[model samples]
Target: MTMPEQITPTGDMTVQTENLCAIFGGCAKCPGHAKAIDCGLVHLNPDALVFCIHGCHQLRVREKA
Candidate 1:
């Protein structure tokens, strides 16, 4: 995978502005899949990072306090 040029930190999370197609297993076989990929934002949380913009997949993160 190609690394993003810049990764900005947003509060307790960090984000990289790049195309995450490879990680998300390409675009979904749907009408709006293209649009969703184009407008999607790759978010990295404490536990996992997801490349979903249309809520296709649900990612849960549990932080141990």
Candidate 2:
């Protein structure tokens, strides 16, 4: 996957200002798919540093390897 160019830090996970966003709860397109579509997100936490303007349910965390 292509990472966003402008990523803003939110605690640990970086949010993409361009079009990336957290797909909370789940994606309606298929079963449990975390995707970035149409420059929007679903059921995202309001407090999340990197999130879509729409908002989603399931929260994803990133760990450096």
Candidate 3:
């Protein structure tokens, strides 16, 4: 699946792709993250969080340490 352009809450436009999960990072915290990646609906943005457009709609965000 192709990535979709979406407007983020901060008003910045972000792009996502099927390979995003691998590019940014895998969503190990949530099961849905992996499912979305497998389904090719979730994409990742370096500046934003990873989320699924279909299936689980899981949001993946890196927690600051």
Summing lDDT over every window of 10 consecutive residues in candidate 1, give the lowest-scoring window: 30-39
lDDT of 3 by residue, 1-65 (tens): 24434323334335332334332345443333233334434234344434434423445788999
Winner by TM-score between candidate 3 and candidate 2: 3
How close to the true structure is residue 4 of candidate 2, measured as C-alpha lDDT? 43
The TM-score obtained by model 2 is: 0.19
- The list of candidate 2 runs beyond 4 A from truth reads 8-18, 21-48, 53-65
Task: Name the regions of candidate 3 deviating beyond 4 angstroms.
Answer: 10-45, 56-65
Quote each prediction's TM-score: 0.25, 0.19, 0.21
What TM-score does model 1 achieve against the real structure? 0.25
Where is model 1 more than 4 Å wrong at Cα?
A: 14-18, 22-25, 28-48, 54-65
The worst-scoring run of ten residues by lDDT in candidate 3 lies at 28-37
| Candidates ranked by lDDT | 3, 1, 2
Q: What is the lDDT of candidate 3?
A: 0.39
Specify the highest-TM-score model's number: 1
After TM-score superposition, the amount by which residue 61's alpha carbon in candidate 3 deviates from its true location, in angstroms, is 24
TM-score, cand. 3 vs. native: 0.21
